[model samples]
Target: MNTTPISSRLHIAIFGRRNAGKSSLINALTNQEVALVSDVAGTTTDPVSKAMEILPIGPVVIIDTAGLDDTGELGELRVKKTYEVLNRTDLAILVIDGTIGLSEFEENVLKIIRDKNIPVIGVINKKDLSQYSEEDKRKWEEKLKLELIEVSALKKHGIETLKMMLIKKAPYDDRELSIVGDLIKPGDFVVLVIPIDKAAPKGRLILPQQQTIRDILDNDAMAIVTKEHELKETLQNLGKKPSLVITDSQAFLKVSADTPKDIPLTSFSILFARYKGDLEELVRGVKAIKKLKPGDKVLIAEGCTHHRQSDDIGKVKIPRWIRQIVGGDIQFDWSSGITFPDNLEEYSLIVHCGACMLNRREMMYRISYAKSKNIPIVNYGVLIAYVQGLMPRAIEMFPLAKMIYEEE
Candidate 1:
């Protein structure tokens, strides 16, 4: 249960107007005081998430966000943050204030949710306080053209029915898009080339590495972990030819050199490029590198925030490499963590992190947004492989991606 990463879990976000029983719905759903309850207009200023197992639905992350109707300068900021939650939200629960009925705000929120193609559950909260009857409920259902579950969160009424609805609407097939599982067979050995550098976390493997190893095991494949330097030795020591070799983007040069061409080779970032985003599109973005001029802007986006290391891959290494390849004072911009810049049209290209910390929805949103803006976007792995002149060999395992690279 604890093994599931939050990023991988089903993200169910509750959104509504201030004092709309959003917090109350969260608490009742979890059967605990997971979210703060108050008479105040805005108790949850930021998105707060709790990970737990809802049977039949399995492991999930429930997010409670600030009300969309929050006002004032600070409240507007809070509301903006709440909207950002939609980027990562897998499923949404739009809580309607039973007394107030559906307002323009709720209708607009519904529009945005529909626009994203996210499956949602409409919940009419504070049901006990409302004088509305069955006919009114039918009216809401007719108005929205979707089922609405009425729940008196304060009274803990209809919570079970809501949970069942969540189970029915939940997306359980995302795990089918494995990190490294699909490439290897049950008994095949897969080698991982991880480099423990200054940027490496002190005590444990990073999220991408950990998730990859777990995916291999889950698929009943053997995962052989080794440092980038020991990749040659590890491959030699294997009794049989391993199915695939996955390395960190930083070590693509050395690892690609060590791994035989006969064996399929790729990187964690590349895997995530496919797992979390569009692989073929990203592969196409690599060609944009050749067109970059000195004065052109490149946006480096990271999904997680951390202390910058002397040779941090996102901050230092990527920028330095881009300068070396593209040359001559390219205006490099950086954005890290939750908020992705809306002004993508300002950049010629976007170099994104592996995005292991982010869920698929958010990463896809960024990729699609960049595409919509007519800006080329590529991830750490694909860009590194491209720059190193080893992209063909690195992506040979995936025919479609390789074809895209070849065509570009």
Candidate 2:
């Protein structure tokens, strides 16, 4: 891929009331006409996301959302969509109309952002057009309990200051998580067992595999790629035993058998279980497979939407396997991309995809939501390995989760 994937980029969503210059601020932030701008209110009917590089922040996706104060039935729908954007937003800029100032709508949205624990910057846009006394500005800030920066998007004023603040507030500077980098050091060999099946994307490896290889290379490790059937021979022919053997979940059984016990074994999706969300929690969720009855409902969620193939892993293969293992008429529901189902109480278990198409924030939100609802949530790789009785081996690379799984 020539550009960074949307899932890997930081998600910065802009929120404000109608005529708050939210679109104009986005254009100023990007230094381009990223969103349609006009004097008209509610020009942005839907969330428009632009992926670009912002120097210190690197690759980031900035989203412009519809006004939360929109009225009528259609406006309500648009507002609902804007609310959904919070699930994926890493950073939020609550744009305030300089003339109107902060109202009940802004206050509510601010409360929601704080409850979600997302980093936010309050900005009063249209600074050039609206004039407020210093006392009035202080009063508004006091009411909102947030410091507001005065910015004129049309004048390109205070835009540099905002960018600097974004870099400082960026979460990754404090978080240390990696796909496969932490498992091995430089010059170590890592074998990737890829299956060349009908489901494999044409002319390229899938997202997880591609990202895994990139991470390995980024860590200065050597990556050896092979198919499932050749895994045995590939391991035998290697000059040195690899530090780890990473395989697709579909080839778990065969890859496990071929890989020596000395070498750690895991799958792309399993690594993602840690990289994207909570690995220990997913490990715990795998145990719920034994509790699933024939009539239990399982929600299979994906981070991206796509046309389903006849032998699609999420739609067909996963459901078929779960049925064979559970041995009953289990109900399966599917939710994909942007919005997760709010009817979470109806489901017994949630089987999420690897979340390659979602940022860490959204993935964590889904997992936490499932926890709040008291439902077990496991990802595709973890569930598959657990059902196949290879979960311990699958998670051997991660010590804490593996210990927890084995102990319990």
Candidate 3:
């Protein structure tokens, strides 16, 4: 929300070994001494991030990572932290010392990035002094199948070209908005039930609700917003029946009962799961609820900060509901805002909230991480449906999965 907007920002990560001029490259690119440059090895321990408006590309986060070949226990920890940044990175600049070319450490990092399917631009730094032969560059290019760019970070050369290349490489738009636009035809009515409770912010509407209305308007459809208490009267006063009703997951039972079963009904969280995350995985994650045993651990991950709701959904309602459904003791672990643990092997299942604030790459990375470790992940709506004995009705939006669930 600052002058440098986060919207549509490309996350550029710079990785290399100690004294590979990674820090100096960052300084040269930004046209300022943005990072600490030193001849000493392992100067940058933690990942340093800066946001700038690079023309053509617009806003972007430039990350300077620690040396991959760092030594000792602290060095290993730093390297581990650097790898974690890759999850959010959209583009990578692998800076290698021109004299030495590609080493085993650099190759290992490249392999990991390639495994994640992220694009990489190889930067041969210290071009001012090192006589890195053309033969070396050509041979490495042919071998690695990567175009090597010569850059003198000390003299600030090839910085503009790097920016241009990044813009050309990074994705144009990094968001998902399918259901809100596709479901309602032009001029059709869509009722959105938003509960104005303690959880409701002081003056602003939550992200999902605001985005839903915007998408409806974008599609030339009408969106009417009202609290839970007013929903019955609001529906009654309407001249025509709404094409669909979307409510908060917490208010699903009452809203479902109030709205006619004939009209299609779903929750904002469910729509968000489909829009910004993998709906099928979440639909499957709900199955873990049935398998919950006594003293099982469930991780509740929320993208936004927790609010002062009477029934704080993630902390209170979700745990309470799970216990009732499982009819046993279930321990809950909570994570809020921008942080998610690197290790997720401990939890039996992970129940995440609709990640409207996060980008697709980040969401998929989390999903992929859990899935690789064979841990199930579900979102608010799907989890609530399983709790409320309406798993079939709630997931009716996804036909194949509903059919599969029916068969199961």
For residue 123, model 3's alpha carbon misses the true position, in angstroms, by: 1.4
Candidate 3 lDDT over 8-63, as tens digits, reads 35788899899999999998887778889999999999889777777666778888
Model 3 off-target regions past 4 Å?
Answer: 1-9, 27-40, 52-59, 171-179, 304-311, 337-339
The TM-score of predicted model 2 comes to 0.96
Candidate 3 local Cα displacement, residue 106, angstroms: 1.2
lDDT of 1 by residue, 134-182 (tens): 8988988888878999899999999999999999999766457888777
Taking all chains together, each candidate's TM-score versus the true structure is: 0.97, 0.96, 0.88
Q: Which ten residues in a row have the lowest lDDT in candidate 1?
A: 172-181
lDDT scores in order: 0.89, 0.90, 0.82
- Determine which window of 10 residues in candidate 3 has minimal summed lDDT: 1-10
For model 2, residues 1-408, the per-residue Cα lDDT tens digits are 227889999899999898799989989998999889988888899999888777777899999999999989999999999999999999999998988876888999899999999999999988888878788889989998988899999999999999988887777735567898788999999999999987787899988999999999999999999999999999889989899999999899988888888889989999999999999999988888878998999999999998788889899988998899898889999999888999999999999999999999999999999999999999999988987889788887678998878875
Per-residue lDDT, model 3, residue 201, is 82
373, model 3: CA deviation in Å?
A: 2.6
Model 3 scores a TM of 0.88
Q: Model 2, 112: alpha-carbon shift in Å?
A: 1.1
In model 2, the Cα lDDT at residue 91 comes to 93
lDDT of 1 at 223: 92
